[model samples]
Target: MTQWVFDLGNSRMKCAPLQEDGRLGDVRALGYGDDVAGALDGAIPAAVTGEAASAVLASVASPARTAAAVDWLTRRFGCISIVRTQPTLAGVRIAYADPARLGVDRFLALLAAHARGTRAWLVVGVGTAVTIDLLDAQGRHHGGRIAPSPRLMREALQQAAAQLPAHGGDYLEFAADTRDALASGCEGAALGLIERSLAQAEQRLGERPALLLHGGGAGELASHLDHAMLAPSLVLEGVALWARLGADG
Candidate 1:
């Protein structure tokens, strides 16, 4: 029996068939602005959904947007399950007293990290925003920090300062032009935050934790951090894990 998992983020919807063994097959990504109805069209094959045993989702999008996507899924798949941030799951305990306040994506990412190993981890998600969470070998969350992504930083600069441009730039050691400067400065800020977090994590954990990077914007910053391992489908992986565990039930 096949299962479907959808990871609905701020900018895109990443969907894939969750294999019986818990691996994803043939991932499909769709970008959406304000709504996801159109993007889901024909993305999943009808035959696949017809024979599917279950469907699940992990979303960090707005409530209205989530409702729309859930509505669509229900219409096509009969029933759909959703993953939510919990205070504790699969031996992992969240730092938040109010787990619901924590983003579902972050919580799922933590679950995915813990499931992969018992080692200490610094899970960094670079997307609409950059989020860094520390997970110890014992499945304890040491809290996390969130900051504007390089793209968001550039957009903010352009929006507030009339002359700065948000697009068309490349990272450089020493920027020779305004575009390069903006790119470097914004990207540099993200890198600086991660580096500082790494140092702090080491001090707190008594050893440097393995870094796991995910999200669309991760590629731009991952090159700067040699230790980061890119896990592009982390959230979906978490969604699949949660579905398989019957936690979404």
Candidate 2:
């Protein structure tokens, strides 16, 4: 039975404790904060039985943000945290330049999708930022692009301009009131950004890759996303895949 899984995401810090018989599990989201190592050092032990699997595979948006978390994991596990640098973990080989520069989360999602044996995919992670990564039918990660998250754009609009009042989401329709309107508009903006990116990807790839969306805000945008299949845990699945692969290697 797999033990524990941890993901220090772009926004919140989350961990899950798996059962002995492989019956799925419960995830705990430790609220976000400034100190990655300090926050994670404190949270990781209490969540996992300390003796649980020390191998933590993390995906970080910022290299610096990931470093501190890796440092903390090192102290506890005595095993260096394996920061995912592309070129595949399970079956997804990153074919982008400076392969290590790819986001660990995105690669892991691609890895997880590949393990499920999908021939191709447009792995989209929606959180503080929305990234659209592509993998060809041959299970190779082509590359990806990043854009301001719909929420961040909305917040930026509201914060920079007083009247907007900071709103964001996946609502496709216009709303009746001011706040709701801002929210809906934000969603519209996100939709447009993703739609165009997907369109371009489809054009280049010659088909609609299986669309997978993961991250904190994925729930809000998943339904409205033109994507037929969506799972918030793609990253976790990838993490799980990464762990299994590491064990095998």
Model 1 steric clash pairs: none
Model 1 quality (TM-score): 0.96
lDDT of 1 by residue, 84-140 (tens): 898888878999989998999999999999999999999999999999999999999
**Per-residue alpha-carbon lDDT of candidate 2 for residues 51-140, written as tens digits (9 for 90 to 100):** 434555575736787777766666565344464565545556787777777777777778777766666777778888888888877787
- Tell me the spans in candidate 1 whose CA falls farther than 4 Å from its real position: 51-53
Error of 1 at 50 (Å): 3.7
Clashes of 1: 0
- Provide the TM-score for each candidate, comma-separated: 0.96, 0.81
In candidate 2, position 229 carries an lDDT of: 68
